[model samples]
Target: MAPALKRSYQFVVDNFLKLLLIPTALAISNKYEEIMHLCNSMHFTSLHLLCASFLIIYALTLLLVSRPRPVYLVDYALFKPPRSYRVSFAGFMEHARMGRLFSEPKSVHFMMKILERSGLGEETCLPPALHYIPPTLTMAMAREEAELVIFSAMDSLFSKTGIKPKQIDILVLNCSLFSPTPSLTASVINKYKIRSNIKSFNLSGMGCSAGLISVDLARDLLQRHHNSYAVVISTEILTPNSYLGKERAMLLPNCLFRMGAAAVLLSNRSSDRRRAKYRLSHVVRTHKGADDKSYGCVSQEEDDEGNVGIKLNIDLMAVAGEALKSNITAIGPLVLPASEQLLFALSLIGRKLFNPKWKAYVPDFKEAFEHFCIHAGGRAVIDELQKNLRLTNEQVEASRMTLHRFGNTSSSSLWYELSYIESKGRMKKGDRVWQIAFGSGFKCNSAVWKCNRTIKPPAEGAWADCIDKYPVHIPEVVKL
Candidate 1:
């Protein structure tokens, strides 16, 4: 009986222990699963918050560093004189004061021979103010020239752009030879009655390259002031600047330097992109004024008789060569593609470290620009540039034709060249055009522009009436 009781108690104890172990094991497993689920949910939430924070920072950075608006050339107009102002080469010499001076006949003849190679046509126009006796250089005559040429160009441009005077926020006027007390800027402001608070700049004595300098200035100003309009006037008052001295160098400007002016409008407003003609891509300026030879290469001075005129250094060509080399060096890196730049870098390295006689490569600018508007300073200038740049005849045709028609209208000549190109319908969308200028400050300036729209044949422009007759055979000399 005792053995049976002991065995039954042991069995009951074993069953109780087994029941407790089963329930506790189930509870432990359930607790472990809850803890793992809570950890996974927290980890996922943290990951999602981190992704949101990264996106917010990137969006804020973009908002803080907004892109700047591009500067564009809305449109432009150039002045054309009346028919009475047109003078043939013979007609010019027949009216010269030199014919009366017995001592000057030889010098005048020599100068005429030089003019034969000047690349000027018979149709070049002189200012009406210069028709007077003693060549009318008075302030009143100067005012007349400016009113006729500058005002006509500006007025026409205003009409074309349909822009009111009040709309112009910035005004830049450049007249190298004739700067008055009120300044050309004030004169423009006064004529148009522009706003009193307009930003006005008058650049004087900078010579033919002043036009591009003015453009560069306007571009910078537009970049700073959002959605603005600027008007730039480029002209040379030929009436007061004509040199009547016996010195041949001083007399060169008389054979050239015709009456012309150009008015350009630029904008930085986003809405203007549709109407704009060109977007200014780059402006590179280089000055060699530190070199005494270059500084004096082109200068204005008084002769022994007290008549003021510009004197060209006999070494002007050399100075121009050096200046151009420097200018293109700086400009190459800006406009050149990565491949060209790398090659140029390699060539320099080769010359510096390996071989002293390694030829420094001349970049082919034609690859970067479809059209080139070299300054119409003279035939020699054109020829030299053509040779130096290895440009084809067609590439320099616009410049030559502009010189033949306008006879070096000083700072405004480049616009006439561009107008010639546009009138021919050669300028297409995305085509790049280059304008290179040389000035009295011993400066070489370049501006690159990309056409925004396909250019059509202009209805009325500087080249409108006679563009068809041009690209004609120009002789080395037109006999009197």
Candidate 2:
């Protein structure tokens, strides 16, 4: 047979029984006596063989499709700041230039207050620029910071996975604030000497959710390019993009955003299944950029004094809530259990038909996922998500601890939270993890991962030092 005809024959041989079995079973009620009589008269077991064959085919096909060779997360690496980089609340106040810029006595006091109650631990690291005589945002400083973070994470990731830079077929790097002249993609390739033809991308201005976006992008590419490996690097360069202004909104990013990065390796090859740590199950990204409220909520621009800073609007939480609602709505059908789906549908119907204003039900996501990594942007962001999702303190512990220890690592925060969970031995084979992030553009994106094998905490991960002491109490108000 010709190649096309052979393929058609094989497809029919595989699926024709699956198609024929259901209607045959359904027809049994009307034709039961006739079929039995015909079978007995003909002294033929064709009917019995057909029924048995259909059963076998149906079961095999179900199993085959259910267990697709999903994209595998071979391994990941996180950038852990050294002890010298670690800072206390007092150190941040003295070095961050925020205190010097806000020389007025009252303004300084307010800034100190915000840092104290920011839910960040004393160990969060500031960038090298902040330690200078006068805080620097020079291009050289940005390059140094970018190189330190990106190289560190990638080196560790390559070492752990035993995958060389030349082996990577696709590279996606995300840095929200820093977009240099040569571009980060060129920098990474030139340094590593990757093959000239390797596909590469340097994504800027994606904010905290850029990591998920990178994963989504990689997943799509892997689907088109078989047996390919993709590397995603998520980092934020704080030196040049550091907000130096004293505006409360601008200053918030300074206290919250920290220096960190993560490198993840994803492979669609069948050989990767045995060694891979997690399988990529689902990725849902929702953009509210078209809406004025979500679009203007988190924006990076210069202030009246020509000081460049990211201005976080007061309605950020509300905007985030709206974005999250849209995200879960799209993802719920895929992950939610039948019971939760049915309840949500009934409640939605009731509100539309009866009350017309009844509070719509929020499907319990805890039922869908074994672990949750909510965005670790800030205390307010985590607190609001916890309340909105009705999550327990334990459920949000990883997120809160990631924020406290690493502060807001931008696109890398969710990975830090996932590391926290793994460090505590919370991840198990077949377990599902939900990672959700909110970034600038008021975007909320989620990626679902299923543990492919027993996950062991990496000895050199960011949480290796303090994972045991997390979930600590934080006072509503603290004085630095």
Regions of model 2 farther than 4 Å from truth: 1-69, 96-100
Q: Residues 289-330, candidate 2, lDDT per residue (tens digit)?
A: 999988999998888889899999999988999999999999
lDDT of 1: 0.87
TM-score of 1: 0.87
**Residue-level lDDT tens digits of model 1 in 1-480:** 276884565455436667688989989797998879887877667778899899999999887667556899999999998889997877777767343431478667866786788899888899876765546678988888888898899999999999999999999999998988878788888898999999999999998999999999999899788889999999999877777678777887888788899999999998999999999999999999999998998999998888788898899999889989999999998887554566678889999999989888876677678999998999889999999888999999999999999889988999999999999989999999999999986999999999999989899988999999979787777665
How many pairs collide in each candidate, listed in order? Answer: 0, 0
